[model samples]
Target: MIRLPSPAGRRQFGVAVAGVLAFLGQPVPLTAQGFCFHPGPIARCSWFSVTEAGVALSVPSDEDPNLTFQAGALANVGPRSAVGGVLVGAVFQNDVRLGVRARYRRWLTDRLTLDVAPGILLYNGTFTADSPGFTGELALGYADWLGMTAQLDVVPFEFGTET
Candidate 1:
């Protein structure tokens, strides 16, 4: 059995979320107009995921697949266009990285859209390599079903010059 909030409780929770969203410079849905990067044209906070596959420039002690958990905000930059960024953390492995990314979303209709984003990334890991590495990625994604999106990126890292 699942416990659900009462109507009054739900209202208060919604109001609190609205205030936090406002501080993030995002629009409060069904209330005011500021900036929104919703699922389609109507819906806020779509659940999404991003996957990345790439080879490290420097070979490590143990070569394994790289993966992380992704979540963050997507904002509309213009008509038929929006920008979104995500933070991904590791769950299993000896390393974790925090990535800041941006994407361009183009809407074909109110329910469907396409997007591409290229952004810089910073990596931190527990390997013999450098502490932080500079990187960039490009992704193509599809947005549907009330702002939900799935994305894949081909990321490549450019190791800094050895001093």
Candidate 2:
């Protein structure tokens, strides 16, 4: 059996749709003429982990402390422009984060790419922290990611080589 939403639920759905359209930079047009739409090339998705040890301020601490776990997706806006959204969760505590970034990637070589993303971070936990900053990364791709987060031993044909 299937159930339908009430009138209030329908109204809420319309509002959510409107918000999404606004974010995508589409004009709210009641009537329009012919418009050319091109989505262009799509950026590849990548995953990375941050785990390091030692600090100058601290004499000793947990070796290779697990600080954070993040997962996100990257979308290519143009040949060199990309954008992404990420969710971060603390490994040792109950801290959660949500962030979005505008990025630009340069193809250094046929198998290597460099990207820089600057954006804001929003978190909710014991001590809330918000940062508006930029982050950069260099990726060396042979084909795709291997041994990434899981042990699936699968080959991902996205975001690497054209083969």
Cα deviation of 41 in candidate 2 (Å)?
Answer: 7.2
Clash tally, candidates in order: 1, 0
Per-model TM values vs. the true structure: 0.45, 0.37
Model 1: C-alpha RMSD to truth? 12.3
Kindly report which residue stretches of model 1 are placed more than 4 angstroms away from their true locations once superposed.
1-38, 42-63, 90-93, 109-112, 127-132, 143-163
Clashing pairs in 2: none
11-120 in candidate 2: lDDT tens per residue?
54455445433444433232222121221123332212222121111125443433544344434444444344333333333333233333344444333445454433
Please, what are the lDDT tens digits per residue for candidate 1 over residues 1-163?
Answer: 2223335434544554454345346543452244444354333433223343333322343646555554555555445555555544443255565444554556666556665544333444332232232334333334443233343333332453421
Best candidate according to TM-score: 1
Off by over 4 Å in 2: 1-64, 77-81, 93-98, 129-163
